[model samples]
Target: MQTAQLHMTMTGASEPRTARVWLHRYATLSAFCTLVLICAGALVTSNDAGLSIPDWPLSYGRLVPPLIGGIRYEWTHRLIAGTVGCLTLGLAVWLQFADPRRWMRRLGITAVGLVVAQATLGGLTVLFFQPPWVSTAHACLAQAFFCVMVSMAVFTTPEWGSRAGIRFSGARTTEKLAMTVVAAVFLQLLVGAGYRHKGLGMNWHLAGAVIVTGFVFWTVVRALRYNATESGVAPAAIALGACLLGQLFLGGGSLGAKLYYADAPQPMPIFVYVTTVHVALGALTLASAVVLALLLFRSEAQR
Candidate 1:
């Protein structure tokens, strides 16, 4: 989730201090931890444990009361989420001081804002009794925060800034197309995650996967046809495209194969694991695609 790749770069600036490197390192780690938090929240939904806590911000009215805890599944997720939120808040403050870039600082602020909003959504999910849209928004916001965090990590590296003379063809058309994919994949994920959380309407999620498949197919084709860059970006588009296609197959097959075989006599564990992998890969694909698109647009804009 730490941007496109971690190959690092040939930095001319006498590689920054250990502390500076540590800051970037923690920011990336916190962001990834947030990603897992989102997935954990999804698992809570999948297991029907969302309301098991039944109380706001306090696990049964006490902070350090119990680790053996009530509602093993639900309260545990809350504790993890609490940890992630604090980590992100720390990262936000650290970014403000560590990176002097105004835009970067603002992005950190926006990330924190998203964390707050997502926390509010989580509370509403409990207070309102698991409204679908609210839960979906919570999931969506988590993805957004992940996207920004990865970008922050990328920008912090010396190779990304004014060197490499790297220019992207942000041609409005391509940029918009990429953004459209980001929006499409994100929206589809929202629907899918909501379904799994609410434990209802497999059909709806399957339908979403189908629709997302179309958008992803078109995205790959567009990148292939018009994106002239054949260096770093070329591989990104290919890798992204392949992952999307593979995800579509895995996600669809997970549900379909489950139904098909379950109706018979016995089914393989593949069904469950397939779904798990689908969801995990879905997160990965969403993150990587957005990063690729942002890099594409950023490089293009500088030209």
Candidate 2:
């Protein structure tokens, strides 16, 4: 044990108490950057600004472009994406060296890989003139990347590694139900992405919304009921519920705005704002479900 500790210290482990807090903050910032990236992507789509720069990995052969018209949105989105990619890379490397858990190191690597793939897909979406499939895939991948960041955030917490395992009755059943809710939310996001990009999956998206909403409602109730025993359940459940309600309101506003401006010569600002917010809220909902599910499972496991 002394030799292992010596190796860990020499290999840049640093002080655990301070390093853990820094890791948590790093993960949180990565998640926030990802959220901003999602909003920027949404704005690009809602405003029909995807092709504003007409270049991939560059804007008109320059790293920076004049912030004008659609170029502002597109360039700013690219900047945010680049920043997120860098942050994820740093977090992954930091986890590999500083975090003791092998699984967490692997997750960090996976996040880096996903960020690279996501960036490639974003470029392809532009190079291909925003093909429906590519763009939809890009959108879906953004949510996946966001989920990864959220997981990293959760795992970095002191409680995650040190909490005493307290098994409650029906723990397995609760985990399974939470898993269902997470899956439903992800599927609904994918369907919604398709519908947003190509109008090809609105019916499916609507059906999925119903299913996801039901599962979310079920999950929230279970969490609340389990709150008497599990201290972690209530907060996560409340966050998920709030996100769901916001998503519902944003969805309605998006639809209403679209219909109200269906005959306009140009897309109205309100429509753009509503649709972007809807997309952003959808990402948040998925992240919340993912975090809640992971917390439930983590809480149930015997540490």
Candidate 3:
């Protein structure tokens, strides 16, 4: 009888562990899908296909329009967006029932809300003929949603829960700097989006880039120097640094592509490709900074 009881106890304990692992995997999947959706959106914008279908929630008044020219980019973006929405809804429902953390559940709901808003903004962009301000807002919100998805992935990681408390000198300063870096990166994204949509000038975007670069490096150096031994801190800082370097290179390439293609009748394919990759890399950079900030804040909270 005691053997059976022991077996049942072990089985019950293992069940939740398995479920947590699956939950984390699902969260990670949702985050990856979100990133892909962002890339699709960038492709549409870069190709000037935002209004190729001239309809909302459908293409050419059908479930699927003929994939030709700009229609293909626009339609693909819409389809990917639909997939992301479903994934996010599933993630939220799973977290609501399976996760024991109340805050995480709330975050899941918030993710659902953000996705809904993002979809609405997307539809508005199409319906309104892609107004610059609306498009810029849509782009900005997508980045925010991406960050939220990333946070969910991080929160669900087993290490997040099991992290041993470690004392890091100047943690408060590091956390504050990390927060500033996140804000700076986000603002840079805003400026870049505005420039892409013709709501702002390239000069402004360039200026924001310089400011963000300084902030990112400063934060990275501080975190690596002071919290290098901390489990999450060093990795997050390193990731942030690596993303910054890639973003800078992509930014320069995108600028060159645009200048070279400025006189072309339509956007050159190279220009489109470079700008699309730049947008995607920009999203990754913002996500990296966000992850770093979240880690810093988490460490601070644990104290």
Model 3: colliding residue pairs: none
- Per-model TM values vs. the true structure: 0.79, 0.92, 0.92
Report how far off residue 138 is in candidate 3 (Å): 0.5
Please list the C-alpha lDDT of all candidates, in the order they appear.
Answer: 0.69, 0.84, 0.86
lDDT of 3 by residue, 41-98 (tens): 9999998989999989878889999999999999999999999999999999998777
Superposed Cα deviation of residue 184, candidate 3 (Å): 0.7
Q: What pairs collide in candidate 2?
A: none
Single out the weakest 10-residue window by summed lDDT for candidate 3.
Answer: 1-10
lDDT-based ranking, best first? Answer: 3, 2, 1
User: Per-residue CA lDDT of candidate 1, range 1-303, in tens?
Assistant: 112122222333333444456776787788678667766765565445677777777767876434442266577677787887798788778867655456777888887888788889888988888887787777677777777777776666554543323344436666677777888888777778777666457777778777777777777677767774633566667777888877978877877866676675433456545665676677777876786676677667556
Best by lDDT: 3
Clashing pairs in 1: 168-299, 168-300
Candidate 2 lDDT, 1-303, residue by residue in tens:
544643553454656656777889999999999999999999998889999988888899999888999898899999999999999999999987777777788999999999999999999999999898899899999999999999899888766755424354566766778888888888898888889889475789878878888889888888888642564677888888899989888888888898899899876899999998888888888888887777787667653
**Sorted by TM-score, highest first, which candidate order results?**
3, 2, 1
